[model samples]
Each structure stands twice: as structure tokens, then as C-alpha cells.
Target: MYTGNLSNLILNSDSYKTSHWAQYPSGSEYLSSYIEARKGDYDVVFFGLQAFIKEYLSTPITHQDIDEAEMVIQAHGLTFNRAGWERLVDKHGGYLPLRIEAVPEGSIVPVSNVVCQVINTDPEFYWLPSYIETALLRAIWYPSTVASVSHYCKGIIRQALEKSADSSDSLTFRLHDFGARGASSQESVALGSLAHLVNFAGTDSMTALVAASRWYRMDKDMPAFSIPAAEHSTMTAWGRDGETAAFANMLTQFGGAGKSVSVVSDSYDLWNAIDNIWGGCLKDEVQNMGGTLVIRPDSGEPAKVVREALERLAVKFGTTINSKGYKVLPDYVRIIQGDGISPNTLGSIIDVVLKAGFSADNITFGMGGGLLQQVNRDTMSWAMKASAICIDGVWKDIYKDPVTSRSKRSKKGRLALINQTQGQPKTIKLDDLSTTDNLLRDVYVDGKLLIDDSLTTIRERAGW
Candidate 1:
């Protein structure tokens, strides 16, 4: 379960108090009410705090046990009381609104493309910077990482498919996202990786189904597989016994339901089991019963296992049995490869499988950690420097950097982000608002969010 302790830390931090320490105008009263109503929900408070503490604090605090005495004193100092917080909220006008020109959620964006931007909801509440920084950064980083990797995998899959002779079979490719339960963070594991898969246009509907049910208000029983004519689907079952009754029972169950069964065939002696159970017995049963059988090799060298399985199928089921298309008996029994498949390994396996007279279409890939844990180490550093502060009806750029480095300098004057989609890329300085043809549009105005794009919409926009 995801404990929202990070949210709590942000709410109860002195930095938050310092940032959103002002009052707002009449139009932005909703922001004020929101902060007031949820002031005492310490769980939410702790959730916000977790992010802040992780970023700012030198030492770690146990999420299981927080020091209450220290918390009370810190909360008091941070102005957590009703009156003080209301005063702060009123001063800042209840919320800070950010106008961002992000590279949409799923797009394969390189480093230095402004992924997002944040600003005050009310111009007067510009002081609320530190309070929002943690959440904003955390939200963008991991999802972007997953999306980038997924985009790379798409290229790899396309390349593999291009080298195949049977182009018709490429359309039925499956890419599964098996990283959710093992991702670095629980939020990223569940939500961020789902965003990645959705963006990549993958066939793993289970990830999307779970995300929709949990995060968005969608029906849980929504089907994962669909087609215009027939509803084709895949079902997985595992067992250790080579020719035991358990394997027979499962085969019967799968065959009875009019669904193709993919059995894990390498539990005992992989070669022996395939010959005795799958090739000798189950093959005839499934063929006579009008069912398809798929053998899954979950261990050892994928190429070797696939070659051995194919040879066994040929000898036992007869060399004349067609393994392609939907008509023949052995055609129903295919090999699905899993376990420790990296990009390089997958490439090598494809080479070997095709060389042995087995078409690339004969195998299925179930990839996991190699794609998920892979990182593009390129660093894209982001810093929000104070651009301008108003004083006595005059605005001036506020620039300050304690350590001066050539690359770390901030652009001065009243700045506006000019995005020229048609022309050459350049940053132009504007002294007056009317000077530029296009300026950064307000995404969130007066604490009311204007850009409300759904996850699916964002995923499509990613185009991985």
C-alpha cells in the first residue's frame, strides 16, 4: 500500500509556511477553504511531509514512528494553527497556479525540453515556491523515465518485426509490463509505469485496467482483449509434474472452455517432460479436442530452449505437421519465451530462432526488469530562479546565485516563454507583453486548474 506520508511532510514544513504565507483575493476563496478543511488530517499532512523530508533533511525519519513532541513544536513553528494558517492562506489567495508548457506526458522528450512549469495562482501569491517544488519534481521525474525507456523498447520491437518474413504475424505482437510489483517506488511501480505502458501503445491491458480501476473511475470488469470478428485471448497456468494428472486436468479445463492453453513445460526435465507429456499425450488430446497448446520456457537460454522445443515438436508430432497458421495440429502449439530477456539477448534469440528455420512469428516475448530498471543516465538539471518581483508599481528581475558558474546563470528581465513551432528555436526577451506573437498560456488560473487532460489522452500524446 502507498502511504501518503510525503504529502504530510510538505503540509507541516516551515518552508511551506514561508512560501504560502500570504492571503488571496475574493475570487480564489476555494483554495482557502481547501487548505482550511484539511488542516487537521495529519495523515495527509504526513504524506506531503515525506517528500519534503526526503529532499531537504540530511537524516531519515522513520515513517512507522514520528516523534510527536518534536512534531507539535515544529508544527507550531511552521504556523499550523487554524488562525495562523488561515492568515497565510488568505495572504497567498488560497493556492498557487502554475502555467506549464510540458512535452505532453508520453512523448519521447530529450533533456532540456521544458517538461512542466509552475507559477502562482494569484500574482500576489508568488512567495509560495518552496511548498510546491517537491511534489512537482517528484511527479514529473519517474513517469518521464519510464516513458523514455518504453519509447526505446518500441523502436527495438519495430526493428525485430521488420526483419521477419511473415509481416502478417507482426500485428499480433504482445508487450507485457511486468514491473509494477517491483519498481523502485510504489507510486512509480503502479501509476508511473502504467503511464509508460499506455504511452508506448502496448498490448498489456492488465496494467491499464488496474490503473483505471484504482486511480480513475472505470469499470473493473472491462475486457482486456477485443477484436472485430473473434475475441482472441491468452491464458497462463503453471505446474511441475511432467505427465501427472494435474497437467491433464488443466489441459481439459482450457480445452473445454474453447481457449488456447499455454502451459509451463520446463518444471521437471524440460526435454523429457515436453516429449512425454506435451508431445506424446497432450498434443493428441488438444488436437482431437480442437484446442491450441502453447509451451512457455521460463528458464535457461531462450534460444536453446526454443530450438529444443521445436525439434521435440517435430519428432513427436511428426515433421509433416504445419506449425504456421490456424489449421494444423502442431500449429496450435507455439513457444512463448520468458525469463531474463534483455534487449541484446532478445536480439540474439531472434537471430538464432530464425536461423533454425523457425519463423520469428513462432515465438512470444514476456519482458520485464531489463526494460524497467534500465536508465538513461543523461542529466537534465532544472532550476526555478526568481524572475521578477513587483515593488512600488514597478517590476524588476530578481537574480541571485551564491555560487557563480557559467552554465548556472539566469536570464534577466520580465521573461515570457516564446514557443515557435514553425520557425527556428530561439529564446527572445520581451520588455512589453505585446512584443511577442505567442506567450506561455496560463494552465492553472486563480487556483482553478484549466488544463485537465486525462491519462489516456496524455498517453496518446506521448506517442512512444
Candidate 2:
């Protein structure tokens, strides 16, 4: 069995030792959320917290843990509240000291709004999440940002399809996840790719598939699918002289399966592979096989390379313009740009290729960092702040309003997300919170899991 280094396990902030004062009465009940999509006005997808709570909240604080934790604090030249912590442990019987209510994972909540509420159920444990905030924010930040980006990209593809393709049937597969190697960690691959899979069905990251199946209770039929394809290593293993053999080999293997095959063509010469090999040599095989020949360009300017490749493929294999005024490539051939694909670049690439007369159906996107890791909490200006504090058997509205920047000011008062039956959702005070119909559900309480949603259910709720 693998054991961790003690220093890494035992180290923590001195502020966490006594930081409850850093919060209003020390991290009291607070309703916080992705109140603003500083990245843009895009709605935020509330997700990943269920997974976080499931993994981390399976057990609660034990007196032994508190005693050991207290020793670490005192060793760091900090005050350790042995009695205070023991009281909390004794009262809660070692469960998490907090309660969390969130909009169902995958519910598209307004970015400038509340998605969850964090409260200390036991007064003695108010200081607990003062340290836990980092992980909590992280749980919300990663998946929410990733889901937002993917959702926006999906909207772009949907628009491009409506305007450029014969049908929008390929919307789900237009943007594929090729970010596993680009993600920061195994957990990142799971959270980021699961978020993206909320919007798209094509993913090259198998690690994400396992995560969705295990955590979200999903099957292969739901989100994420991949096709048989060749990478540079697979081609180069055949040697450049054997490059023709590589192409022939790929076609020979998957061509007869009546499914699409993607070939990485830019290893030695992109145009040569597209013309001499894919278009020239395998043209008959591709046409007669009843499956697509996906030409993937891995280098060069995304817009320029994709546009130019489409032009070459059209000249060699031919094309037909769709009713939408954009030309459609022959059904047997298409271009998917996996290199340097992001929301911004993905759009420009599609536009340039479309202007060159290729339908959006003739193109797809595969993104790495931009789709998975290229974001921060500030990307959406997400924050979890105490809006209200319970003291003296009364709730008091509290917030920060720095005159230096109004944008940094936090929301005030106990909050309720009033998701209307026929109107846009609004945030109101708890006193005015009359509707039990509010979308927020108690997702985690103390040490118990209150909700568990499937990937299919999430996708349906997210309007996929």
C-alpha cells in the first residue's frame, strides 16, 4: 500500500488555527455562489460538489483527529482549541460540522446568483470550514467553469450547425474532449471531462468515462464516445517509407466497420497525407466503406490550416454546397482540428473554413487545456462569502462593500434562490423566502449524502 509523506499530510495554515475570527463570527452560516460570470454573462452549471462531498464527507471529525490536529497547531507556534474542538466532536459525534444545500448538479443557474448555501449546524464547529473553504471553492470552481465553457462551445456549434450544415444532428459530437493528457491530475480529468461531457458526447479521455460511470451512475450510452483513430506514434511506427502502409493499414482495419476513422496527417507532410494517401490512395476505400475519413491537422494556425486543408480536400475529393450557402465536403471525408482548439479559436476556425465553403458538419473540435485547465475561479468571479451570521438567536445581514471596487462587494442577508415557475430566478432574503419550490436541494448534511444524480439525469436537466 502507498503511504503519504508526513510533512505534506500534517502541514496547514496557522490562520486556520484561529481564523474563525477572520470570518464573520468565524465562518458562520453563509450563502455563497458563482454570483457573477466575470468571464462573461454565461450561466454557471452547478456541479461536482456531490462528488466532492461523497469522497470527503464519508466520515466526520473525530476527537482523536481534533487532538492530533490540535497538537500540530501548537507545534506551529499557534493556539490550539482543544476544548472547543472536543465540544464540537462530542456534539456532532464526528460528522462534518456543516450543512450544504445546492441546486441539483447540472442545473443551469444564473452566473450572477447563488447556487449553494454553507452553514455551521453546530455552533462549536463554526471554524471548521475556515480551512475547508479552499477545497469547497475548488469543488465548485473547476466543474462549474469547465461546464460553462463547454456549454458555451456547444451553443456556438449549435449556431454554426443551424447556419452552415444540412442538419444539426452532429451538435453533440462537434466538440470532442482531447484534454486528458493536458489536465492537471486524474481528478481533474474526471471533473473537467465530466463537465464537458454534459454538453458533448465525443471524448477521447477514457479516464473521464470511468469517472462518470462510477460517480454519476452512468453507462456508455450517455455522455462521451470515441472512434477508432491513429496517433502520430501509430503512424511513425510504420516508418515514413511505410507511411502509405500506415494509411492503408488504418483504412483496412476500421474502414470495413462502417464507422468513422481519424488519421493524424501532419506528422511528415499534411497535404501529402491528405492528397496522396487519404484522398489519393484511400479515396475508393473511404467512399465504398460507408464511413467518414476524419483528417486531423495537428499543426499550423488553426483557422488557416483548417481552411486550407478543407480547400485541398475539396479539390481532390470534391464537395457540394449545402442549402445554407456553406459548401459541404463529400460525406466520406471531413476535417477535425484538435490542435490549438479553444472556444475563441474554435469559432474562428469554423468561420474561416465555412467562408471557404465547408459546412460545420465537415469539421469538429478537440481542445486540451482551454477546455479543461485554462481557467480560474476569477474566470467567473466565483466567491463563497458569509452573507448572514447567526448570533444571539438572531440572524444578522453581513457583507463586504469596499468603496474601492463595487464589484468586490458581496451580497448581504440570508439568501434564497427563487427559481420561478415562468420567470427568471431571483435572490431574496430568507424572511421573504416563501417558496418550498426553490430548486436548491439539501445535497449534503452533517456526514450524510442527501442527493445523488446520474449523468443522464444531469444532461437532461441541463437541456442536452
Candidate 3:
């Protein structure tokens, strides 16, 4: 929906980038910049670049956009490159003359390797790559960070299930997305939630569905699904006196054969809802239901509360031991911990359940702000730096080696990511390897998208 001036690519950069058009060396004819995450606890899930290229770079710049950018930049005390933009519009049909090569979307790349390389196809626009760094880096880092976090959580859950569960049948639904409302904007909701969906099939974020359909070519087969669930307002609206009635309503509406429903049960006293009401009053109603009832506790120390809730629920509903010797509740009951979940806490909660002799299948997770808003560009120390530049048809290697922080040092020369049969992928200079040896694919060139990845394709590459 962002149209007119807001959608103008010329205005998407930082105001200082306007001045950068003149800051480059006088004979600078081409500049090469590459993006990489210099440090992190684990490998990254490289994503979102395809979506950005399709959404932003595919649109041709118009004369009106140049005019609007000129007025805004001048009024804001920055010089605008009107003639440069005009020439781009006139000669290149309004498309940027840039070639973007990147690792395949959803590739689980290790830290400190080049994931994307950007260089101008037309030497006249040497500054284009660095000028668009603001938008380009933002596009790569945010969703890629979210995806990495979600991917890490998936590994935690999978390990727990392997250690304690009889089967990993519910692995894909182990972590649910509850981060939509906690996101900073709808775009964040869409991109962040979609990144989570790459590793899981459960979500309550609908914006991610629309985005997947639009950007990742998921229209025919949607990548995520959600069940009918209740929040605090719905439970409390019936009054404390009518608490049992609200529980009954959810069971009546969504509880049936081959169906499930989630109800937030911590509005008042979480223990009372589990012990007095669900255990005493509606115990029979729950057991006789044809489908599973997921009880969500939204306020507590996550690990302690989940362990206690699992113990209390087993006492009332009874539990059967799986082949792995871990206790699992009957098909009619389950627990979901939606409070205080983040990458840091996720592994501990799963570990706690496993240590308590409970099957990982007996529980799922719902993460909100922790999943979407908790990360930033610095989560993995992501940076886009000029590694090489061309002047008058001669190329020279360039990079920064900050003595203050060795981790901030960057790579030099034109980089290429190549696969190694034995270990991690290697980042080498392009001159050392033939073009065919590089794993970096030309995904975008002169306004044309060469690789259109689908959600299914991304899921496969991410090891889903």
C-alpha cells in the first residue's frame, strides 16, 4: 500500500547517502560491496533478499520520483543528484544498473562469510551500491535475524523431542507465532512472522500468510496454519463468576474430532483455573471431548509454571508413559507456554520438561515480542562494507581492519562463497575461483529478477 513518494527508492536511503554521491574517489567507476554477519553463536538463515529485490528494485523509478526526492533532499539541507537520477530514468528506463549476487535464499550460512555481493553493472553509477545500503541492509538483516532465531529454537525443540518423545510427529507445530501484535509495524509482522514460518507450520499471525502469498509465491499452498484461540478479554468478559462458562464455550465451539483450541487460562489465578475449574468442574467435559484442548498460561516463570502445570494436568487428566519412558498426557489435553519466551529461555524450558520426565509432545510454545521485536541488525553483527572498488577499469581491493575491535574487521577483495565438501562454506576472492565455482548466484540484474524462490523452496533449503 505504500505508494507515491513513500515508495520512491530514491528517498529510502539515509539523508547522508545523498552526500555520498560526491564522497567517492574522483575516478571511481565501480564499487563492490558485500554483506556478512561477522559474529554470532550459530550459523545464519540467509533470507528476505529475494523479497526485497522483487518488492523494491523491480519498480522503475519515475520522473515524478526524482522531482519529489529533489525537493525533499534540498529542503532537508542535502544535495540531490537530479541529473544522475534523470540519466538513470532516461537511459536505463528508470531501473538501477546494479547486479546483485547472493547465496541461495534460506541457506544456512556460517558467520563471517559473504552472503550477498553488490556491484554496479554500469560504471557511471559507482556509488549506487553504497547509497542503497540503508534499505538493502535493512531488508537482509531483520528477517534473516528472525529466521536465525527461529531456526535455533527449532533445533532446541527437536533435540528435546528426540530425547523424550516417542515420535516427532508434532515437531513442526511445536513453536507457534504470537508476535504480530507485539511487532513495531505491519511490515515487521509480515516479514518476521514469515521468517518464523520457515521453520514451523503453526502461527497466529495472519499478515505473514498474506506476505508469503505475495512475496514467496505461496498462494496455491499456504505455508502456515492457525487454530481458533481465545485471549484474556474473551475469558474475562464472561466475568469471574462465569469463568467456567467461557471455558465451556471454547470447548463447545472448537473442540471436536480432529480439531484443537487454545484458551488463555491465566487471567485470574492460573492454579485455580487448572485445579478447581478445569480439574473439578469441567474434568469430564474435557475428557469426553473428541479433540485436544490446549491450555495456555500467559503470566509466570515459564519453566517453573509449565512444569507445575504439566504435573497438575497429569494428576487430573492422567498420563500414559511413552516408549521413551516419558509421561505424555492423553490426546484430549496439552500445555502451551506463551509467556517470557525468547531464544535464551526456549532451550531451558524444553530442557526442564525433559528433565521432569515429561514428553516434549505434551507441550508447545507461543513466542511474542521475543520472537519478532527482540532482535536487531547487531544480533549477528551484520554489516555491509565496501570490499573492492574499480577506478578507470582497474580494480583494487579495499577493507577496514579496526584495531579497537577485531570482530569489526571486514573482508577484502571481490568475494565468492564456495561450498566445501568437508566443512563450512568458504569465502574466497573471485579471482582465485572460476565463476562456476562460486555458490553466489546472480539473483538480480538491471531490474530483472533471475531467481524467484517459493516458500516451499526456502523451506527445503532451510532444512525443514
Candidate 4:
């Protein structure tokens, strides 16, 4: 009945996992903590560990389940230790005896080292479950990567918006998540979408929308939003000859005052559709309908095509200078460049738009693979390692100082993330920090979600 990925279970044996289990010191679990931090590229890492609460910690595997797993792996001609896993689970009544303390959801945590910590909170259970490390950590890397990438995209757009838009409040909705279809799986879509929603409110991925709500305890008032739009199939289905009819139908459906609709214009000649069909035939109708028409160019050299398209649109609907001295497109017309968009390239495209005398507010971005799926733990160099271990009621600092890569060296002792705008490396010993001032709070402890963050609270912290 469970016919999904067995990779994490079967293939993980090859991660030299026996060594991982053996590395921990004997009598190591009076109270030990490991920090999960993005150790490279990013200085401040946004926390998006909500998915693990539902998928891993809440779904406990019994001793019988471990025995069944051993049989399942042996079916593939590989050896597994059912007895080892069952013995570990027996100490805690088939539940993981761990506590996860994290910077509140959406908190901008300094990654000069440690952000979230996974520790054995219960003294009755000695030795942290080795397999659970991989289980919980695998869930964070993807969502955290997406959230980090998406958060910086907001920074890029925010800077551009401050220079061009009259009001900078629309930065959150400027980049829409179009990544659900391109994600590796539906579960991948859910994780990536919820991560994106931490900073922005726009999405085209209904899979993401539904998944986030289901897993994160989100209500019907979902954190993400979307607009009516057509894909290549929907547009090309009408045929080139019936292009005008297709355009007319979209107008009839979505072209009302303040309404936003995206119509793909490159199914045929991109220019002819914009000039003849949309501008030539429907210009007055668009003006009279009093709605925003989002012209989507799915394929072409991004900077050149967007600049050329915007120039022609300015010629058709006309433009006015904003207070920031950039040309602002008419209220009813805009451009959306959905292809070839990454964090850097997207900002550059808007930079080109600003050079071409158009405000950044006139264009928004919809990202697919780039926004959600096409990154890894290395994208931000995420790692979770044992930093402190307690033996015989003594909390001793523990770390790995590899001579080859000093950056791989782990921090020692518990962590408390501090928000500092100075933009330098932030490091403080846990003993030096007061409990009230520490940003990392108890999130999960012994099969209970201690602190559940509301979507609004998360949004506000993310600079809503």
C-alpha cells in the first residue's frame, strides 16, 4: 500500500550510516544538542521547519513497524537492523524522546552559526536516535532552501520597488510561486509552497496551496493567493486563427475593474498578438473594462523581449512618470516575465526595465523550478551536527575541527539567535545569553507541538 519513495529508507544505508551511529560517545545522553544551521553563502537563514512536525515526529513507527521495515529492506537483498531500531524505540514507548527548539517561524536568524537545535529533552532516554537525525533534517533542507532563496528575492524586489513603485507594500505579491507542477512530488510542492508563503502571498500552485493548509494547520483563510491565468495548452488549443476569440473570452471572464488576469501571448507570433489582437482590437475594451491585463511572454531572451514588449505597450496605452521619475505603465496594462527567472536574473531584468524607463511596479514575476525545486542543502550549505554533549551530568563542548575545511567546523554548546542589522557574523555563547532575550523558543517536545505559529504572525516577521 505504501508505494512511494523507499530511497530514504533503503539507499540511506549507503550514507556510511553505521559510522554515524558509532560516532556518538558512550553515556552521551544526559542532555545533548545539535544545531541545524546554514553554514555557507547565507548569513541570515529563515526557519521553515513546520513540515517535519506533521510528516516525521507526529507519525511514530512502532517496534513491529521497524521489524516490518527490516523485512522490506531484506526483500531488496539488503541487510537492516530491526532489533537495533526496536530497542531504541522501546525506551520511549515507541515515540522519539527529542525536543526541537527553533527561532519562531519566519524569524530572520543569524547563521554565523546555529539556528535550530534538536536535543534529547528527556533524561529517561539516553542516546539520541541516530535515524531520526536523517529523518527530521531531510525535511528542513528543502523548505529552508526555498524560504532562504524566496526571502532574498523579496529583498531584491523590495529594493527595486522602493526606487520605482509609489507604494512599496506590494513587494510580497510581486513574485508568484509557479513551481508546484515542476516539483519532484506533491509533498515537495507542499513544502516549497508553504516556505514561499512565509514571505509572499501569490501562488499559481494549487497543490502548494492545499498542501500547506493540510500540513501546517492553516485554515480556509489560506496564506497564499493566485489569479486566473491561461497556460500554453489553453491558448494554443484555440488555434492561431481563433486567437482573437480566445482573447475575447478571457476579457469577458476576467476583465473587470481592478481584476488581474494573465494571458500567454507567445503561442503564435508574440508581437502580432500584442499589437493586432490585444492592442489593435481590444485596446478600448481593456481601457473601458478598467482592469489590469497581465501580458505573459513565456519564451524569448528575457531582458530584450521584456524591454521590447514594454516599449510597445507604452506606445499603445501610454505612460506617465511616477514620483521616482520612472515611466509607469497605465493602470490596466502590465508585463509578467515567467521564464528564465532566478533570484539574480529577475532583479537584473527589472534593472533593465528601470533603464528602459519603466517602473518595477509595472512588472511581476512567476517562477517555477527556480522558486521551489531546483536547490539543495549546499545552496546554503545547511548542516546539522552534534555541538554539545553531556556525560555524567557535565555539559561539555564538542565539535569537529577539520583541517581541510575550517568552515566545516561545528559550533559548541547551545545556540541563541540574535537579530542584528550590522550585517556581520553573529556569534554568542549560550551561557552569555539570557533566556528571555534568546530568539530560539521551544517548538516541539516529546511528540507534542508546543508552539504553533499563525500565518499572520509569520508574515509580519517576514516584513509583510
Alpha-carbon lDDT, every model:
0.46, 0.77, 0.91, 0.74
lDDT of each residue in 418-446, candidate 1, tens digit only: 55666432333446446555333334443
lDDT of 3 by residue, 72-182 (tens): 899899898998899999989999899999999889999999999999999889989998999999999999999999999999899888889888878899999999999
Clash pairs detected, candidate 2? 20-26, 35-112
**What would the per-residue lDDT of candidate 2 be over residues 123-168, giving only the tens digit for each residue?**
6555565546666777888898999899988888898899888899
- The TM-score ranking, best first, is 3, 2, 4, 1
| Model 4 agreement with the true structure over 1-464: per-residue lDDT tens digits | 75544533323334444334445567666544555554644444454566677655665557656755665666766556555566557766666677888777776655555667777766544445344556566676778778878888888899999988898888888999988788988878878887888888899878766766666666447777778898888877888898888887888998897798889999988898888877889888778877888999989899899999998888888899999999988888888889989887887898899888889988999888998877877777777777677776778887789999998877887666654557433556678776436667788887887876666677777667
Residue 267's C-alpha lDDT in candidate 3?
Answer: 91
The TM-score obtained by model 1 is 0.64
Model 1, position 77: C-alpha lDDT score: 69
Residue 42 displacement (Å), model 1 = 40
Clashing pairs in 3: none
What is the lDDT for 17 in model 1? 47
TM-score list, all predictions: 0.64, 0.91, 0.97, 0.90
Worst 10 residues of 1 by lDDT: 37-46
Report the number of clashing residue pairs per model.
35, 2, 0, 0
